[model samples]
Target chain A: MKAVGLVAEYNPLHNGHLYHLKMAKQITKADVTVAVMSGNFTQRAEPTILDKWQRTKEALSVGVDLVVELPMQYAVQPAHLFASGALSLLDSLQIDDFVFGAEHPDWDFNSLVQAENKFESTDFSKYNATYATAFNNQLIEHTGISLTEPNDILAFGYTKAKLKSKLSVNLHPVKRVGSAYHDEKIDDTSSISSASAIRKAVKNGSAGFESLVPEQTAVDLKELKDVNDWNDLYPLLRYQLIQAPLNYLAQTYQMSEGLEHRLKQAAQRASDFDAFMRLAKSKRYTYSRIQRVCLYALLQISDEQMQIKNKQLYLRILGFNHLGQEYLHQIKKTVKIPIITKVDQKSRDGQLQLDYRAGKLYEQLSGVEQDMRRRPIIV
Target chain B: MKAVGLVAEYNPLHNGHLYHLKMAKQITKADVTVAVMSGNFTQRAEPTILDKWQRTKEALSVGVDLVVELPMQYAVQPAHLFASGALSLLDSLQIDDFVFGAEHPDWDFNSLVQAENKFESTDFSKYNATYATAFNNQLIEHTGISLTEPNDILAFGYTKAKLKSKLSVNLHPVKRVGSAYHDEKIDDTSSISSASAIRKAVKNGSAGFESLVPEQTAVDLKELKDVNDWNDLYPLLRYQLIQAPLNYLAQTYQMSEGLEHRLKQAAQRASDFDAFMRLAKSKRYTYSRIQRVCLYALLQISDEQMQIKNKQLYLRILGFNHLGQEYLHQIKKTVKIPIITKVDQKSRDGQLQLDYRAGKLYEQLSGVEQDMRRRPIIV
Candidate 1:
């Protein structure tokens, strides 16, 4: 079977997402299309507008045959670790092809991958700047392209992770359509809008988002959590920060270079997440960077645990159609990791345990309870 | 120079509280009435309906000469520990007379105190029930009084702790008036209403509670936080339970004899706090018992920390009138512990640190901000 895999948040499964899904299937002439969807927390280090289960239903409503959760370990990080998680998840399923949206029309995937390798091998102490800053500089020096647009950078990370994983999957890039990556206003001149713009419109209770997203995404958005914005999580995050002092945060992943002290001080003074961001932000950390760190602190994800989950840890089926079910049955014997469908499966796998904990956390904060006994969405 | 001390939660400074204060002053003929108030968390092991400062203002407005916070180490516990903290706080100030409401109107206080000493000395191995049950059984044996009224048990604990502290403070009791301790309805015949009933009426937005609380409490209720029932705190508590395993909860101050396992299991299956309580409760563990355990789990108060804070820790002056200032000045040379009017007092005191952390936790859960730098209330 020729299976094509795609990595996505599908936060709301907009028209853009549906278009990418259809193109992936058509371009590869694949028998089955698999999507590794971001779970409650996404690659942006924030909760997905809609949770994994809701987005799974939307992905199935589209032409996709299967949806799997991108374990929170990988989904709630910067691009590199996130890509490694997605590639390992798809690679575990023996996917033969991979498709994604790219902003740059023409790019040298090999050169970008080489740049990533160099950046990792080189010692970071020589540069006073963050790893991202130094890596972007290397990209500029090698590819002569900024490569900073959301999908473009992700595509680079994806290519590098795939190379390292030694996967045989063929990479296909579809030119991104619609407003630019950072555009956050729905119906802003273009008929097709970015997921962010749609999310913003929905959060603001604007009617414009209805026309922007597909029928399934639109309906799901109404039934799912209002918006998993940082503001919605302020209370939990604030409490977490207050409980975990500098010494406690120092043990967490992504807390280094004296960031713990800054975070601890900010937590004491800041009234909310936004205020904490403002109080903590300096030249060294960006808003998104601090956000991701605070979230890691909130979940108490330690550095040692992050290393364990650097690659794909397990397969979790969110939803599967008939074709997807048959494909899973065929690959079950060869799949590299344990597959979990119920909450009771005690694998002792750190990633899976953390995923379960994250599910409970998300449920508490968002007031959306998903029964552990729930079966995968089948359509 | 005579000073009468009172231990109180004064959760909202209701009419009942005011009546007790007046009776205490008149009966003792005291020049100063010092109240050792429960801070953010009360003896019931729950957040106070109003933050300490607002309650302090109301307390000062209604004849309380001084308002000192009962360190949380003593407040969020069962009757014994709660009374230990309250008594220590009052004793440190050299209070001459102590006054409290007693349900057993005709019982001799000295006889009850002697019975308490006997209960402590007698071996408890014969009884299979909790220490409380055994003590109460012994008390009935000695005094022929079945003393289980909410205030009656606390009064016993308070008297016992006062005896141990050896403070020269004389004990006085005023008859409790109005509704029963557990009453949850307003206007149940008597003019004086229970604090619980008044809190319930205000929480339910019933307008009939005005006659039940003092004028200052009525006015301050509007400016204070909305009611902080367990439902408002479920997310934080659930997060704490999920993060800490049974072994971790075993280390907490209140967790004992496998209650941690029951709490952790219920936290997963139960939807809210009430559900968790129902799921975890049994003959051995009542609702209040489970509440204190969950509260200690939420605060992550360790057994070691509790042991370190078994007595007088610090005196945090929430507010004081002119007479209170004069009393403190007169006793300043002999005050037993550090007196604090600012949040930054560095008391190498674990109880003080816990009090500060509890304040922050209460602020986060109740959406009330008490600035660490704010001056103490004075009238």
Candidate 2:
């Protein structure tokens, strides 16, 4: 009755993702494989190239037994909260082991976790950089090796989250293949392609995606009428920024250091989305941070709202096979919150409010209509 | 020293608008002509074809002495509030006369006003129609005139507002010409054209606009990158409609009669703006009504917010000629609310809040940049 779980975006459910899912299942020899996947929007505050439901269908078609939505509030955040949120969600399912993608799987987490605990606020105050940069600098100082690679950083976040949850789930790391996280160009590496490169190619209507993704995923990406991006969400984000006051924006999560003023000024004059991003970006704020801030501002995710821990959240099933259904039934009583396959007005509250807003906004952003009444895909 | 005032959209300031302005000045023999023009958004709850400053320049070039913004809270409203807001602002300026375009100039306002005052609310409750329809029916009952013509309705609203204001300003009605209000086709009629026709022609890149609009307007419109319509705004409106809860939507200014429910349902399935508008439109709610409510919802202009009368308003001049400057100088002490030419963080409040939002949203919708720091056009 061993269950293995993984956190992913599966933005297009590409070949690389399928490989990772298969690897997780085979290596762990687990009875059921669960994947906590991002919904419409992703960690960097960008909408998925394809939506959650479509990705779920592709995941089921590939091999994943269960696919549950990583509620949007957690999905479009920094690596830490994203990892924490996904791990927290998976932990609720009573899984025995959690597998993850990592740049360096053999990194000493025992010492790394101890070092993170020993890191002092006083020692980090010398650098005028982001918390991530400061932490990376600290890691570099400690081990003469920086944990700045996307997977390494995320793996560390996952370890920290696992520590926080204090769940019985054992952590397992599998070496990642393919291009680096931020790699913009797709190489001739046959099957393992970065999701970012795949998205970039799909957006500009380029070829070479066929070899990188699963047959279903390749077809879906090629046929996707609206590949959600900042360009599509720009108008809405601009509207939100302009309509709301600076003080109101200031209340949004991560809208500190007088960023509200900069956002307002940028939102006022920037002609389009790219222009706004450039205008808002500064030496102090990374483009990704600005993007997340903009998303937070749009979603009205205030600092107070972010501070309030989303303690009770239901597992929203996207798709499942017979094994996954059996796993759900076996663990039904032990599961924390209710497992929701379909939603109505009555069942929406807490984290679900933000999730619904982000989901509905994705519909608007993509110009795609989703049926709320549809049952989870069973294959 | 007499000044004649007119309230208008002057969306692009075409030949028809110029003709009306000249007639207003000549017919009244007023030394100064004051135009309380709509800012970024218009009476139909649509973004202007051009920004307020651009429209101001066109208005000044076409012989308007002064252009004051018709605060957004009022501009994108029904004829009654549009007329009332304009009249109230003009009353503050102590304008000698107000000129307006009308389908019928000789309509008996005295008896019509009396009939309007005498109309019982309970009598209209039996009809199960809109308040506008009920009022029009009541008017037809008394005067044997349907009072359904666009200009005629606006004229009636102006008269009612004038009565309410109890201002001593003389009301002058100028004859309207060329295409009708909702006319979509560009007719062979020279010079005077319907604003709707001009907009349609401009939107679809149709010919005959050169003959209809002024040389400057035609030139500006030709170079215009984006003349926003429902399509450009569809994403934001759809996002606004879908993201918000039905109960939350019910509190919007025009969300009544279970319209919130209809809006949510329509938003979920409608693929685009036009589809959403069509799906949302009902027998009880006219297309214009639906558009306005969508706007109100997007702007988050609530029923309570609308109830809170925006009392303290300043005359934010868009442009002014020497005569207009002189008039302002002479009446500087008497002018109500501080006349703001340059705005700062401190200046953003009350109706100005809404006006700035509407103006800034115009920039986003149009993909046009406007320098707020630059002084108004002095022609």
Candidate 3:
């Protein structure tokens, strides 16, 4: 019952993801494939095109053996934490290999990690630039290869996390086959489009996106009456910023250096999320960073809570096929952490509180139950 | 310039309120009429039919010489607190008389207040009943009367507040005219109807409410698109309750006796405000008490902040006429507290934070600017 694992967002389960899944099985030659996917929110704190369950069903339909949720505390975070959290869960599941996509899959990420280790810790203290800019500055000077693209940075993160955690799983980085991550428009001739491009096509009512996605994803997109984006969630964020006290907001995860005051002022004056972002954006912080902080504030996740929950890891299964069930049976006793098949009162309130809260927030947008006694999908 | 002060919600200024205003002028024989009105929200923690500014315009157009906003801390509170807060502001303005409506104008409310003073302090500790129910039990035993009618309860509160604070203003309890306070429909024969009945008429699209309200109120009601109520604000409440931690909710004003757990649990299960209320309600807490607590949670208001703001009272002018201007000038020298005409940065972030937050929440429904740099209406 050997298994290979993949970490993904599978935002809408496009052809790009299908290709990656196929490559995972081909590259590892494992008996079963297990994927740790983000729950309702992505790493950058954006709501997924489809919910975790819907995405899991899509994954199972496309021959992925098992789908487990990457807990929210890990999902809506920096790339390093997201990569580390997913790898930890996969390692616990005793997966033999981990597959991912990167812009430069052949680059020696291990050397980049070693180069970063040599940089002074105080390099992150530069107040005039963002943390990524500071890190890239050092990287380009040492290795002559700056990590700028999304997957490239994530690849570096995977290498760093693997070395630090001393996990036994092997890492495989395959070349991303289609449209780049940031490409917002779908190419009419291609069957593999980025998730963002598919989402954009759906938003604009453009045709031909059906070819880029699986049957399940196309059906989900057709049923999606409204795209769950910042535009729809801005009112809740604005209300939180305008109402929560400065001291309380200061305690939010990653809220530092009097950012609470700046955010509170912006929420007061800005009429929408874009206007809020424009006002809140600064040289020291990226738009994604501020957006993640806004999500933390909206969910009311505090630094103390995040630090506490980070230590309590779990594998929350979302869906599984017959092979996945057999793999789970094989590894049931050997798994180091809890494997939750259904959400009960104890887990929903205790270890799973963060993900539960995040799911409730997403539920407000999707009008679908996220957790709470919901059983994993079996194909 | 002698002034008679009235306390009102005036959710929408109907003919009943107009008659009350005329009666105040006739009975007090004052040179000017002033009103300390609830802003945006009512005593039951419900959003008004119209915004405070619109209601103020209607008040001034109907010869309410002056209108002052009841601060959020006092506006959305229990009857005693709301009565005391409004009376304190009116007393600061040096009014000659305080007038309000009551179902039993001739009842010995001062005696009732004195009788309440004689009850044992431990009487309120009954765990099986609400504070109001406990107080009523004592009242029924001592005075052979239960203060149940809304205005009668307010009248008792006014008497208690006036006696306890030793205010110099005269107390005038006018007989309430027209529809009963809880009546949901307007009677065709009477021009004077309750504000609730008018709001219901507007909600149901039942016409003929135009004759019940004044010309300005009729115009305001005619232009009303969606009636703002708990139905619209429930999402915000549900989000706050479900996302905020128990300790944070426990700090909410009047959220006592482990009610935070009840509210948080109810928010997790209930999809609407009504369902949330049903789950949250108990024998020990009334609907209004729970509703006010919900508003406090939505605003993220803490008990300590409420206590601090309770002592720092201010007179915020909302609108005025020529006579009202002269009266303000007359009291400008003698007034003990600061008078705010426009919301500056200091006040918006300090003294007016709660009101500003409430206004912002209401603004989401009405699509009108609430408080920043806006001038008071002049008639």
Candidate 4:
């Protein structure tokens, strides 16, 4: 059976996302497609607009052949780690091919992947000292191979991970059509935009977003009563800041030398989370980074805990389509670790408890508790 | 006499500029205001929207005490050089005080100036290399005085120039009111914005720009039938790129190393100036820098010529208010060069000819020929 693998969040599958899946199927001519999706949180360290089950069900109903859960550890990482986690899962599943979008898709995929793989060997210690430098160095290294472009960098990561795992999967890249990845403007002509743009459009109540997403995804979003954002979680963040010991607070993600002291001092002075965030942000730490760190602190994710949970372990199932079920059955015999679908009392171990707690927080924060209790939608 | 020095381009006196003049008068309580205005080109290396005569007249009509033109050498420079030229001119006039707008008006001016002066002493070979070092050094030097901030940097430049020149003028910074310098949104609360923001608003044809500029300036701008930007100059830039010898092209302002070779090759292959610029621009050379170099190439300005003209000489008059005449007369004996009030064919020298050519180009490109020919509007 010709099988293709997708790495995504599907955080609430939109129209554009559905179109991508449909296009992937048509272009690849694959019999089955498996998606590795994030659980509660996103890369930006924010709760998803919809519950994971709803998002998973939505993906299955649309087109995905199989739906596998991306662990929380991988879901909230930067591009490289995220790709590593997703590719590892797909490798274990014995997927035949991989597809992704790129601004310049006409470029050669194998050459780009090769270039990216070559770049990993070069020591970029000088440039890696700073965030921008490290990012640009990675770009430069990949550029040696045809994949030196921005979008290709992510694709290159996936290819490199696959190569490392000795997974035999052909790479397919679709030309990214429509507005820029982070462009806030809506171009009615092509109507495709990055998820960041979609989220921003929704938050700002911008017109034309309805046309951007898939029709069903738009309907689902519209049906949802509450739309939560970072600002809404300010009170929770404040509680976390006030309650957490200094040592625990200092160990959160992105928290660096002496920053915890400043954060602690600022938290004491400020009445709200916004004020504390504003006070804590310096030239070195961007507002977004601070926000992520704050979320990590709220989740009580200490440095030791993060170190232990840094790597992907098991693929947790969210939802799947008919083709997805067949692929799952086929992979179950060969795959590593448990492919968790249902969570019972026995499944609530240390890591499972953490996942459950995260789910509870997500449901409470997003006001999607009723949706979570509803039966998972099957294609 | 209590005299205040103004550093400006007076690119046609707008309403918001008039507000600055009125505020300066009230705050400084100066008997006379001396304006050191740009001759033809502006700091962005672009021709002023209007000719110097029309701009001077508008300044005169408003409240300027004296109008002295800043030499073209210093006129089209970066922020530091631009500030130096203006400060030197004000120093030459032996003005007692200088006033400028700052985001945080309450910031300590003297300490900031002291820090800037110290920062300039460290000889750094590479650009932006010493930026952080100089900044931290300045902070250390000024410990217990005041914290270093961004807005203070510009104010500090003025102070340093004055100190270096041994000028008697005291620096006075006014708190900036209204919209932020880089604010993209139109602010209805205060109808004032940075010149950059105003230009963007006008270019975008966004509403509420009418409130940004003076009524007379707005009327003057409206009378100009066409507004041409870089796109319109593309063909001209492209032609210059193709015609100029590679060696000669490299001598243009901001052109460095083998960029001229790159430009020459790009120009041959690209359809237009924009395409050529895009090809030439890399991580090292910014788009704005490339545009300036292209302008310099179009003007046939050589490195030798630029070197010779590095030092500011003659001040070209534009327009002035009632007090401006009295101030001009007061400093007439102390002035180094003969100020040109009207363009005389017999008396106009090489620099004046070049200035006039730049003005003519501005008129042609901006489609403000009729406006250019009009008698100065003495306010």
Candidate 5:
């Protein structure tokens, strides 16, 4: 039985995600579908509105065969790393196809990936500009098309990852449905909405978001007491930056070039997350990059530890259907890495420590146990 | 102008403290009154109900001529360390006498201190019992008098500190009035109440605590939006323990043995400060000692850094009246250490960093700035 793989955050598992999940199976004609979903936090370093469990239940309820966690070290990173991490996990699962949504699905991402290779490595070394801006400048110069939309950039990242890793899985980019990626409000006429739009509606207590989500997602959304976001996490982040020693903070993953001092000073002055972002944001670091660094600092994920964990990947199953169990049985002999269903003492402390810590941090907001003795959802 | 010294947490200065201040000046015949008070956190490692500045104002309002902050390195510590640190600062101020309240003021505290000196050092090495318990066992064996009351313990600590340092100042133990140290509710019969009782009354929104405190303290208490304590700080503490590496946690001041693992495990399972303390508490570690270690972890105060800072004592003046200014001027030439009237950038980032961080943590609860360019309160 061939399996189709998808990479997603499923922040709330909206109708758009359901559509994407449905398309993956219909187009690929696979017997099973596997999803590598981010756990607790998004790539932007924002806590998901729903935890990985709630999101997993939503995925299982929507007929996704298998759901596995994208470890925090990879999840809360840049597009290139996130795409690569997700693709590598899918490659481990031995999936036949990988499906994703892109703003311009027909764009030749392969050529774009190849175009980026020809640029001088020195182009990314400018201290006063973001790496994204630097990369886009060279991309627009070479290909006359700069990938700016979230999914388009991710598409380029996915294609680059597939080529660099020589993964045998096929890549399919379907056109994104509903509103644009940045749209904050839901369109009245559409039955689907962006995750951010759904989150905004849920946060504002606005009506009409229920129509844009699956039945389980709508129930979970209604049950949410508070929306998990950076605002709720700012206190812990600020405390970490203010209290952690400069030398210790300097050891955080991706922390470089006296950014520790910058973050520390910003934390000292800013009382809230928005103000902190404004103070920490500069030409060299994107807002998301700074936020991801903040998360790294908060979780105390050191550069050495993250690097070690990045190489030692695992498939932490969050949920599975009967077909997923059968697919797992078929792949069990061939799958080289550990596939964890229940978080045991040894694995929770070792290979899955980063994700466990990240989940614990999220537990502060959700008040739900994130790991430890929690069994995977079986449907 | 001779000065009399007092050690206080103030937390929120009450009528009892005002009486103690009056007694210091009256009994010692000192022209100036000086106080060395805990800053944002108390000796029990709990955030004070009021920030240091507010408490300083209350001190100065009731004629505490001068108020200096007890640095965080010394403020949140065991009785011996807290006493020694406070006494060293008062000694630097060149005061003629030191006054404090005692549950048994007539008890032979000097002999108690001498008895403690006679104890075998190995008596404290028992891993199955707390240092205080072991010390008390030896004390009970030597003098047949076990210091169980909080004030009595502090009196013994002060006597030991004075004897050990050979401080020239006279030690006066005045009889403690009104409520007991452990009393949680305000007693109607007495106008004086324990800081704990006043805090409880304020927390419960029970009336009559206003009459037990000074006018300024009453106003500060009334204006308080929330009571700052361990319950409010548990999240940050839990986050630190859960996220920080065991090696880093082991470096926490007074975090010896395998307490790091115990704290980490407790933080993982316990949802609140009380529960965490219960889980962490054992015969080997007192609740107060565990709480102090938790504070050290939350503040990320390394034992090495704390040792260095403890030796580098500074007189950080929090508030002063005209007489206080005169007293400071009189002692300016004779004082060996820096007498800080304002928190400069150098001090905030260097000598005062621990207190600054503690203040920042307290600021999260109070929404009031603790340090950084803040001038001492002048009356």
Candidate 6:
């Protein structure tokens, strides 16, 4: 049983994503495709606009054979950790090939794979210095090309993890199409747009985004009225900023020394949350990073908690089709953790309950009380 | 002469800047205003968009009575160095006060000054983490607020320098108006717009920037076509990236240890300068910091050079009115360094030649041809 793997959010599988799914089947000629996707949160350190289950169903309706949850621990992490978690899941299932998108589609992957395999472990003592020395060295030796954008960095992360895992899985990269990543401008050249561009258009109420996504995804977006958005989190963030001890703030993820004092000062002067963030921004810390740190502080994610929860854990099931059922049967004995298909009351551990509560909050924020019905396992 | 001192670039005095000049004089009730402007480069580590002479002439046309050139050593230094240089110039002229903009219009200058004065003796060793730690403690003790934004940090620098110099000059802060600093948005509420926004608009060919700047500055900008921009320096930066020793690169300004190796690897993989920078960026080091470091490396500014140039230096004159002349004469005997209004051709040394050469580059880049018959300095 030849099996291929994908790592994505699906968030609402668009036509462009479907095209990749079809092309993966045609090119790899694989019997099954398993998608290891984010559960509730996204890579941007924000809650997904849609629930994971809805996104899973969308993927299933498209061409995806099976959908497995990429546990929350890895989902919200930086690119490398996210990739490692997804790749580990696929490796455990004994998948043969992994596919992704790249700006330069014609670039050879075999050379990259070979380079990844042959990378040396040098002293990264200066790792905390001015730049990321070890990561760059590996990238240069592997691709013979530099990582330029966020997407490129992510691709490099995937490659690095593949190398570190010592897995023999083949790497496939498809050509990125249409709008450039973070390019808010709509293009008529191709019927594809980056998720960033789509999100921007949605937020700004800009025109020409509908044609870029699948019809069902658009419908889902339209029907989805309320969810936990940035604004909803602002008040909570503000309260946290006011109440959090300066020392405790320094312990949260991404909260460096001295930044806490600055944050504390800005909180007093700012009339609201946005004003506070604006005042807190500095040359070294980007606005996105500050926002993430603020969120983490609000959530009270301590240094010790972060240390323990940073690793990949159980593989939760979201959705699956007929082909997915067969693939699951083949790999059922080899899997490490429980592949949860239903919200089992018996399996609701402390952490799992917290995850479920987060999901419930997400549903309430998104204005979808009716969709809270427990989903049945297709398999 | 009761004069107010300004440390500025003028760089084509826009309307909002003109408003600042007018307001400073009106509020401070000063007879004259002197501006210590940059010779060629700016504090942000970029060359001025227009030549210094052109910028000086524009400043003179507005409310400025005198314009002095901030020596290159001071002009291109970091916030503390830049502030110290500007303060030294004002001190030499015996200016009574120094006025500037602050995000929190309500910032208390006396308290700030007191905090800065007390900081040196304070037990800052208890928070011996980074520069930010000691600075924040001072701010908290002074105003019970945390220091957050770049401008606030700069204000702190200015206050610290003023207190350390023991200059009897008062600190005054005006509330910034219109769009937020570095905000790309165009708001017509107030004429004030950040220099970053104006530069961005100019680069993108957007209109409505004229209203944001003074009329004279806009005319100067129109006259100065084909100015040397960052694009022209890309080749030089690329060469530096390629040839710079990994160890030396590590010592370049913000180039942390491990970052040098990352940069070295990136240089090898990147086909161009921009690609190299992108590859080198990470969560730890921002793109701006990287760009500044690259520029520092290109200029061969070592840690040793930085240490020597970190202190304040003498001032050079650009242009001045009658009142400014009176103000200069009053403190002529007490001034620390030679008030160089005219170039000393016979005494031109290596440093002077270097300064002159940088100025000449600015002239050439501004697309203005110099008349061979004209003297190097304009009276």
Give the number of the best model, judged by lDDT: 3
Against the native complex, each candidate's DockQ, computed on alpha carbons, is: 0.53, 0.52, 0.86, 0.01, 0.87, 0.01
What does candidate 1's lDDT look like per residue over B1-379, in tens digits? 8999998888878888878998998988999999999888887788888889888998998889999888878887888778777777788889988888878756775678787666655453455466666667878888887768878878777777877777677878778888877888776566688888888888888787777777888887755547887887887887877764456578888687787877877888777878878889876665787888777777677887678766447788889999999998999999878888876645412446677778878878666566477678879
Q: Rate the local accuracy (lDDT) of all candidates.
A: 0.79, 0.79, 0.90, 0.65, 0.90, 0.66
Q: Which tens-of-lDDT digit does each residue in B1-379 have in candidate 2?
A: 8999988898778777877888898889999999999888888898888788888888888778888988877788888778888888887777999998888888886568778766667443477677678887777787777777777778877888877767788888878877777777777846777888888888888888887777778788898866678887777777767665566678888788788988987876787788887888876767878888988888777787777745666688889999989888878898767787876656554546666666665665665444356577898
For candidate 5, the lDDT comes to 0.90
Worst 10 residues of 2 chain B by lDDT: B365-374
Regions of model 3 farther than 4 Å from truth: A122-127, B122-127
Interface Cα RMSD in Å, per prediction? 1.9, 2.2, 0.7, 30.7, 0.6, 24.1
- Tens digit of lDDT per residue, candidate 5, span A62-169? 999999999887888999999999999999999999999999999999999999778877544554688888788889999999889999989988999999989899
Residue-by-residue lDDT tens digits, candidate 3, A1-379: 7899999999889999989989988988999999999999998899998899889999999999999899998888889998888888889889999999999999999999999878866454554788888888888889899899999988888889999988778999999999999998887778988899998889888888999999998998898898889988998998889889899999999998999999999988888989999999988898889999999999999999999999999999999999999999999998889999888899888988998999999999988879996889999
- Using DockQ as the measure, name the better of candidate 4 and candidate 5: 5
Per residue, candidate 5 scores C-alpha lDDT tens digits across B125-209 of 5446667777788899999998889889888888988888888989999999988888887889889888898899999999999
RMSD of 1: 2.9
TM-score winner between 1 and 2, please give it.
1
Model 2, chain A: how large is the TM-score?
A: 0.95
List TM-scores for all candidates, in order: 0.92, 0.88, 0.98, 0.46, 0.97, 0.46
Off by over 4 Å in 5: A125-127, B124-127
In candidate 3, which residue pairs clash? none
* Model 6 C-alpha lDDT per residue in residues A1-379, reported as the tens digit of each score: 8988888876546656877788788878999998888877776667776777778777877668888877665666666677887778877777898887777666554455456557676543434332344656676866677555665556666777777778888878776655667676666677887776676666666777678777667777766655455666554454345433466577776677577778866753454567787899865555656766665565455666666755536666677888888888888998886676656544432335435534533543453421224553474
User: What is candidate 4's CA lDDT for residue A56?
Assistant: 75
- CA-based DockQ, model 1: 0.53
- Regarding lDDT, does 2 or 3 come out ahead? 3
- Reference-based lDDT, residue B47, model 2: 81
lDDT of 3 by residue, B108-142 (tens): 89999999877766454544777777778889998
lDDT of 2 by residue, A18-47 (tens): 778888887889999998998888888888
Error of model 4, residue B58, in angstroms: 63
Error of 4 at A256 (Å): 3.1
